[model samples]
Target: MNKSLKHLSRNLLHGVLETLWIWRDERVAARLGWYLAVATNRMPAKYLICRRTPVDVELDAGEDELWSAHREAAKVFEETFGAVRSGELRLRELQRPAKSLMDLKVELVKRMLRHCNFCRWNCRVDRGEGAKRGTCMLDKVSRVSTYFHHLGEELPIRGLRGSGTIFFTSCNMRCGFCQNGDISKDKDNGMVVDPALLAMMMWELRVEGCHNINLVGGEPTIHLHTIVEAISLLGSVQPSRDKLVYLWMMKPDALSWRRLEPAQYLYEGELNAPILWNSNMFMSLETLEILRELVDIWLPDFKFGSNACSIKLARTPWYWETVSRNHKIIYDWGEDIVIRHLVMPNHVECCTKRVLSWISDNMPDVPVNVMDQYHPDCFADPLSPDYDPKYSEIARRPTREEILEAYRFARRLGLVFESISLEKSVFGLRP
Candidate 1:
């Protein structure tokens, strides 16, 4: 078939199967259904709920005290989430508290900036001072490579409208075969965006009908403060009598020419977009604590199976321990999650098989995408001036046989991955 015809056929079949999945699978429906509800304003985003749940901790509370407060507030947030999920509480009925969990998160993340431990590397460079950079090569300020409705994500993540993708600059990991090297490696590649402007970017994507606000990166974990602050700003933008004056005084040069109207900028209603944490699964436990209340869905990458392979391929230390711990935390938390495992060239035994086996043994029910789109790029690109002979093993695409074997392994494990895997061709046509 022609490309266009083939595309149409695939989409039609996909839509049909997606509808059935939503109807049949409770887990699938809860995640995608809640996202759809938030996108359509039927329900409030998780951040909005966080904004409504009250917290009594002081901004400068001691580390132990603050964490205690966070724990208590988390219980309340969970209870509230349960009520909201069960239809016992309506988003309209949720009123913003004087000092909320969202506010506390903003404070905690800012404090973390002083010591900079967003990722497991724990660079402790005092990003707030902007004097030193971390392993991610990012200071306090975040740079945005781009923001748009990205249609190229996994089926459920993209949905019909598309996943609202905001690509941040710089990553914690130095993957030799990095596909988005331009964004991930270059700290100065994109414009530095403040919290307000970042929030505006999110608002624009939602206004254009995106399903979820996908916070991706080089890695989003490095920009935890900026991202959480942006979400807080987006959720708390209520129309007020001093709105015009606020808009006039707060207009930055970046937003001047395309001055948003009061309705758009002020955002009269709750800013509703499910926060999708598209991450590398290398975030600190502290970062994950804050995220548990904010993120509506988790899209994490399980890149390496062993620390040795990770050290060699991604140049990350203690990778197996850190990534697996984070994944188990989120999975056990009962969060909506979809895991992505990229199939690389020549490491199926060391990486692919181990990753699949671990998922089967631990998180068999989580939707996984065993991706086959690896290509030679960045340091892995032999043509690049910076190419190294040591990384030549992954310099080509995975063979068709390798991809098939990976799928076969996943199938043998009885993994719940068909929705995101190539098995969609047959699974989508199922009765």
Candidate 2:
């Protein structure tokens, strides 16, 4: 095994010991890593694989030098061998570990500060405890514009009640078709808050009987560290099986940086909640690492197959390869990822037909959600000459046939979906 893997194994072992000690089950501690892998839909052996040598890892240690932490953890692991051999320990039986989780969260915050350039921009901003301000326009505390029960989402997300939505302000991408253009454009509406406040917000949402906390935003990647910290805090408070926290990424970047901190945090924090990524799959290898270990269900939109369309609509320079490669990565990760595409008025063929063909080739098993939600928002009026009917002289929505063709194409591609409908209407959720 590589030296980094050995170090990671040691760290994981220590984490497992801490987990068992707090949960009061030694057998579960011995097999914690395996259980985590299974729960996250990752192969158990993959835990032993080393992706990259961690930049923050200390390399000056002598061969004889062993970490005092790991040595102590090993003692506990050794003591639990009888329980493991007898097969009495169960993952379902493990109790919540509150203190160990906080310690691990503090460590995660430190690590994020050390190497937290996990966004698509990779601006190399340090956002640990002491420092402030990164490329994501955020500091130590994350500002949330508004958080409440919102019914304006897909079926599974909203369920019977609604998805508890937390809107974070400011964005990495300045997209023209942004529906929440007011919040994204405004610089003052955001309120910087600590993890405890966020945890309180989550608890408030849970008390309101929300199905899940939908982390939507200006750009979730910007305030991801704070978001993850809040997740840790909330998980530590209530270890409920029903409460799921969905991290919605409307931007079609390859992966979300939110997972980088929580991969280990999920187990160490004793969190049973699922981590959902709502992304526009702009493929990146680093994102795959996060998706492989962190995400449960991947909800991504394949915006456009044609680079010209994507460049014009989303202002993305490399749109085609990003969607194609990202779709493949999500596919390789598992069959639980969902792909969606909006049928733009005149760009149906470019967005749906071409993207659907690519999805069929790369990931046919992944569900495709065909949407018909297209209205020229304020951003598209005078600013976007191409999308503006006054400038282009095409004053009409997409024909019904274009929307129907997308659904038909998805079925032809053999893509399964929870629901493939997005009715064309104004997008809003009353506060």
Candidate 3:
């Protein structure tokens, strides 16, 4: 028993070390060396906390109070990005004329890299020096695990063709049962590319008839600089837009020839196609603020509604309180929002129900995809020493009964998602 325990412990520690400064390919090693040699430090004059800590969020607000808050949030959203786009929200094209918005965001991202707090980890590793903290395992050079037109993402996102997905390598949050373990668990899983090459990749996807460019990961927000800059670069080389058809543009007609008030972003050339931010939703407020105006859709995963479940399964602290609160904010801020939750074997009562209640209670309009495609993976293997018997309750696939109950519960809560796959046997269509 002791010998087996020691072997498992050693392998886990080796895994941790490999996340930092380890490379499978020598080409990435050479590029990393080049980045470290030329990259300049942009450390802040004073470092302050960038992550939102646990606070006393009143989860049990009355219907009246919740409705009032939601209304106010909607009003604020309309005023900020309404028929006349305000200067504060559209600063890129407003005040900063003749300057590249992408360049500015890229610069800010590089500076942010010096103190690396893009996610909840807040490891404060100076990635600009081309070395990331253990959790993310990505340096200044962003590695892309894969890029393709994915039709499997929920109907709205995938659309007729598919959502153009660029999956980044390495992750900040390590879920023990992550389906994409080969891509997310290791940094050496993909080819390293700079922002320029990433831009070219997006252009290729656009030419290939992709619907929207979906930024996914291993937590894609970790490579905010690369993603933002790549989008900016792609927009620049392609045709510039006359007006931005945004949140309210869900309806279209033959009124194009009649010019009323133009969409706010006529002055700037941003992403012509809709950009979807497909993330874990464990993001920084500052990062969200920077991307609020840019991202057209928010496709976030509502992992666990119980902090205890999150701590055990995803190894995160205050995951329920932190991400749920963030989800409320994101729902009101974005043009369109989609929440994806995977129903674990035993988590229906503790996690699934709570998540559904919150969404129905506060964000009724936001679409949700209650996923049922979960099964035992690398960490959950019954024979693996790393598998804790305590979690055996959720070590197997969720049953057909549980799936049916989940759909019934979601429908009972008055939640509606046109794209939420009701299919019990399908994989990848969950979100």
- Order the candidate numbers by lDDT, best to worst: 1, 3, 2
* Pairs in steric clash, model 3: 154-431
lDDT for model 1, please: 0.79
Candidate 2, clashing residue pairs?
A: 252-280, 254-282, 283-326
TM-score: the better of candidates 2 and 3 = 3
Q: Report the C-alpha lDDT of model 1 over 1-431, residue by residue, as the tens digit.
A: 99877766664433222442433655456545665555445667888789889987886888777778888999999999989988898866877788999989998999899999898999999998888888887778898887666778876777655677888999999998999999999988787877877787777666555667899988999999998899989844433445433432322322322322333212235567788999999989999999999988899999888999999988999899999999999989888888999999998999999998998888878878889889999889899998988899998899999999998898899886655665345445332
TM-score on alpha carbons, each prediction: 0.86, 0.62, 0.69
lDDT of each: 0.79, 0.49, 0.60
Candidate 3 local lDDT, 259-284, one digit each (tens):
21212111232323456788888877
Q: Give candidate 1 regions above 4 Å deviation.
A: 1-27, 30-33, 235-268, 423-431
- Model 3: residues >4 Å from true position, as ranges? 1-81, 84-96, 131-134, 237-271, 383-390, 423-431
- Model 1 steric clash pairs: none
Candidate 2 Cα RMSD (Å): 14.4
